[model samples]
Target: MCECKALPIRFDYTPKGKVEALGGDLEGYVVAGTKPAAIIMLYDIFGYTEYPQIKQVCDHLSAATGFTVAIPDVFRGKPWSMAKSPAKPEDNLIGWIQSVGSYAKVSSDLKLTVDFLRARGAERFGIAGTCWGASIALTACSQPDGVFEACAGLHPSLFGKDKEFAEALLRPVALVSARGDPLETVQEVVNGKPDLAPKCIWKRMDDVEHGFCAARGDYKNEVVTQRVAEAVQLLAGFFTSNVA
Candidate 1:
């Protein structure tokens, strides 16, 4: 995956879920549910509250699909320090990715989150992520050893390596992308592999910017919110049908 820079984000809405411990040193905001399954919702590098929409989207998914969504604090207590854009040279995004957002580290956290859900009586599992988090989620889905049964990536920032991720997918995938994303790469792969097409859902929100589906989205704009709702519908539909 390539390094991504931070853009503007909005925390215009309040999150409805409560923060709780996910066993050991892990803690995250979990949207309560009555279903027997759970979906692990990973946030972008900005962490949870920096983009309140991350948690809000989890709440929406719970309400829509009745799946208890676990939005883990993958960054723990320390999210990205640069609150505003135009990052200084000292606040390097790649450096943070190599540490807090590294694949080895987040993949371990993903396993822990799945373990916590399994302990909570969740018999089935799915994984979803936005922006940088999507890279991690897709990487896990691509591996046969990964615990998730299905995965979703919203406005994923894969540095144009969608073909690599697509070919390596060991389970179903749902990609809800922005206009700027590399949608055609995966499209071409699935076109050749007819067996893989049914296991995937690719959607593009043409009106929104790169981070529209994640917290970096400005929900203050009516169009962005509407498109986000569409994204939620696509994700909820994918997990409900594929996670079984």
Candidate 2:
């Protein structure tokens, strides 16, 4: 489960993108750039509207990687909560995923996002997801007719552990795992598998929690900032090398 209250809202950094409709009535924050390779960034359980940090992270990745990043509103307009802590269990992090139709609905929405980008002249694509979003990214890349060229999962949760999921990775993938996360088990599986090893890059962040990548003012210490920078650099390199 993610600690939603760990990070504080940052009002200083405003997002550079505009929320536009991407067919199927789904809207996303599209950050325009010059790169031919576009990346579809899936949001965590907090959804897009819950935190400004999520949008800021999207902006940073778009500028840093030079990839036209699009963050689809997977929950449509309904986010779990903007409050640091939810008053009810149904509104908590775990309950929110259950309420939003989970991976099945998110994966369906991701396909629409891919089509939207494809129509906009994006030649290549990299799909990156965090936490609950990572599960959807993994599933998207697993499909035989999947359009993404590269996929990344940062501090993933609710990932499939079966052999089929491992065998379905058709392109390069970077898995950024936090220490002590159950997601590390899948990271180990991807690392140990002979067939998956050549294109798989597993990076484990020591002494950090799941939500460390997102810039949180509350947790903005030197070490957290460094880890976030390192994670961004790693993803930029992974997308550059794999998506061409």
Candidate 3:
């Protein structure tokens, strides 16, 4: 396994937002707004149920960008834990993915999320994810009728060696990779497809590792806050130009 795939042990964020059912057993932490554009945030293996930093990020994006941002419970209620689980991290991640159903099912769930937002007056849309969630964002972008006008992936995972998936993206996308990320493969894919070059933005965080966007609440410093702020800015800029 790559070093970047390791999960952080800290849980540093203070939870935010009101819990609301998103229909069909799906629930999410919604930062409400009256904006015409909405952003859907997919969670990594850790899930978004009790994670404070993830919720904080969602809230920040909504407040900062004036876009309705929703982070759905993709794992339903059963989020994987690195601190309490007995299995290896990799095994637990795989199990969690399988438990939620296949990739197709996850993709369908995302579409449902988009529909839910659209019904609430949101016209354009943006999607962002980290790690495992990044893979889902890619899938969402591939949907023929997807509502996403823009998408962003942070230290993305699970996008196999094949280039067809990357080639399928139709909307503008920003991919932020950590220092050790296997982004060369994706870059190759983008390079080979001249049509995709204009629509794709690749940013590299030379000093950070995967999962650096979330705060573990262990340190009361400015570093994590700054990093998160930078990431949000990048996504915001992408959405501002493409969706907002």
RMSD of 3: 6.3
Q: Write the per-residue lDDT of candidate 2 for residues 50-132, one digit (tens) a residue.
A: 46556766666666667788989888877655464433655466655766747666777877887888788788988988876
Which is superior by TM-score, 2 or 3?
3
**Candidate 1 Cα misplacement greater than 4 A, ranges:** 1-12, 82-90
With a 3 Å backbone cut-off (N, CA, C), the pairs that clash in candidate 2 are none
User: Which 10-residue span in candidate 3 carries the lowest summed lDDT?
Assistant: 1-10
| Counted clashes in each candidate structure | 0, 0, 2
TM-score ranking of the models? 1, 3, 2
Residue 41 miss distance in model 2 (angstroms): 0.7
Q: Tell me the TM-score of each prediction against the true structure.
A: 0.89, 0.81, 0.83
The true-versus-predicted C-alpha distance at residue 151 of model 1, in Å, is 0.9
Tens digits of per-residue lDDT, candidate 3, 1-244, equal 1012112222464444676777788888777765788999887777765555677767766766778888878778776675754457666556657767346767767777777888878888889888777877877777788777777887776546336657777766788877775466666777776765676677887767677764232224456556666666667666666777
- Give the winner by lDDT: 1 or 2: 1
Model 2, residue 33: what's the lDDT?
61
CA lDDT, candidate 2, residue 217: 23
User: Candidate 2 regions off by >4 Å?
Assistant: 1-11, 82-101, 159-168, 192-195, 215-219
Residue 95 lDDT in model 1?
77
